[model samples]
Target: MKPARFFTPENLQIVKRLVSRYPPGQERASLVPLLDLAQRQHGTWIPPSAMQEIGNTTNLSFEQVFAIVLAYPTSFQWRPCAPQLRICDSWMCCQKAKQRDNGIFEAAQSIASQYGVEVKTTSCLGACYGAPAFWFNDKIHTDATKETIKEIISKEFT
Candidate 1:
């Protein structure tokens, strides 16, 4: 069978460096960081080829790596996604949304869909004081409203 090659030479060096951080026989410990690096380098998703390469580099089975990746949905992106819109749907944010009747998250999903952005609901964004928070491409925006959400999505496309 042909070898699976995905990472660039520099990224391969980085993968080796990450693997070297652990004790000689514990390269499996580098799996998560290696997946993270591969995701970042590959523009946000880890493909099967990269998983195979990572397994080979770390002396892990392909199934082992795939299992770990599947376990952490938020950490790894198995497929490509448009810019993300992660809305906080935890207690404080939901309560605030209900009180204000702004439908911030719903509007965000609507706006994101128009722009081909992906919307995900997260537990907490750590901005409870400024509830109704969300992350546009990982940048937190607290005290958000539907208009603000629309504006943010609009700015992203333009």
Candidate 2:
């Protein structure tokens, strides 16, 4: 996390959007989104330069960057992030993770990827309280229903 990072003009817009989420005096709070942008745009994981960029853009110290980066369990190896969305299929969810009209999650998977979000059926997303849950881009959506999937697709991928 020592070197600075450079971004293409298009990707720079994303950085700006992430940075805009915080108040003027709380720029450092944008670190999470900045790191996510770095991983999503650069692929696999956030490199040293990306951490440096986050720290520089947020006007934080290298030590701050080091601590936060180490705190999160970001992966070094790439997975199915090309549109990764894992729907919970634990016993409770197996019954709920479905289209209202169907008994399986196949339709949900199809609908998600049709809108450009790759998906799978997994056991748990730590949202037992919300039986039907899904994980996308490292964030979890609890109480996921058909309408929820549609809305997320429209709001985020559209």
Candidate 3:
């Protein structure tokens, strides 16, 4: 991870306000918001130096800050694609994947590649019934078919 390039004075004030929200001895609670501030200020990505600064600002060690960053799905040390698409890749979705993904991918491939939209798989999205599910624009899409997935691609990139 690179050092964050934009932790300006204004961002520091925001971090102070965010940390102040937590009561004494619970400054760790402020890590998420402060990381969010770091991402926003540094250009939609968090950096190791931002983590270090966060640790220093909150009295946490570098390892402690790193653990939280790794544990949180929304926090990333690098940039994400313009539209990150995550499909369920669990055993539960195995059959559904066979039934649907080929066409969905065919329908989605051109647009996804052209727009730099990412279509990848995850272990689960938490619901077995929604096997073959995916996340688009932060919304879970379950039992998705080629048409539905295409709609998402079209709406987002076309």
lDDT (CA) for every model shown?
0.86, 0.71, 0.76
Q: Write the per-residue lDDT of candidate 3 for residues 1-158, one digit (tens) a residue.
A: 97554479888878888989989989988988888788777776677888888998889998998888788756456657577877777887767768655655455566577678887777778867876677787688887777788788678765
Candidate 1 lDDT score at position 133: 93
The order of the candidates by TM-score, greatest first, is 1, 3, 2
- CA displacement after TM-score superposition, residue 151 of candidate 3 (Å): 1.3
Error of 3 at 91 (Å): 1.8
After superposition, the stretches of candidate 1 with alpha carbons farther than 4 Å from their true spots are 1-4, 13-30, 40-45, 56-61, 73-77, 99-101, 118-120, 123-130, 138-140
Instruction: Report residue 4 deviation for candidate 2 (angstroms).
Output: 6.4
Candidate 3 structure, TM-score to reference: 0.61
Winner of 2 and 3 under TM-score: 3
Q: RMSD to the native, candidate 2?
A: 6.0
lDDT, candidate 3, equals: 0.76
* Predicted candidate 1 versus true structure: per-residue lDDT over 25-141, tens digit per residue: 899999988998889888777889999988988999899999998898787965456588889999999999999999877787788888889888888889999998998865899
Top candidate by TM-score: 1
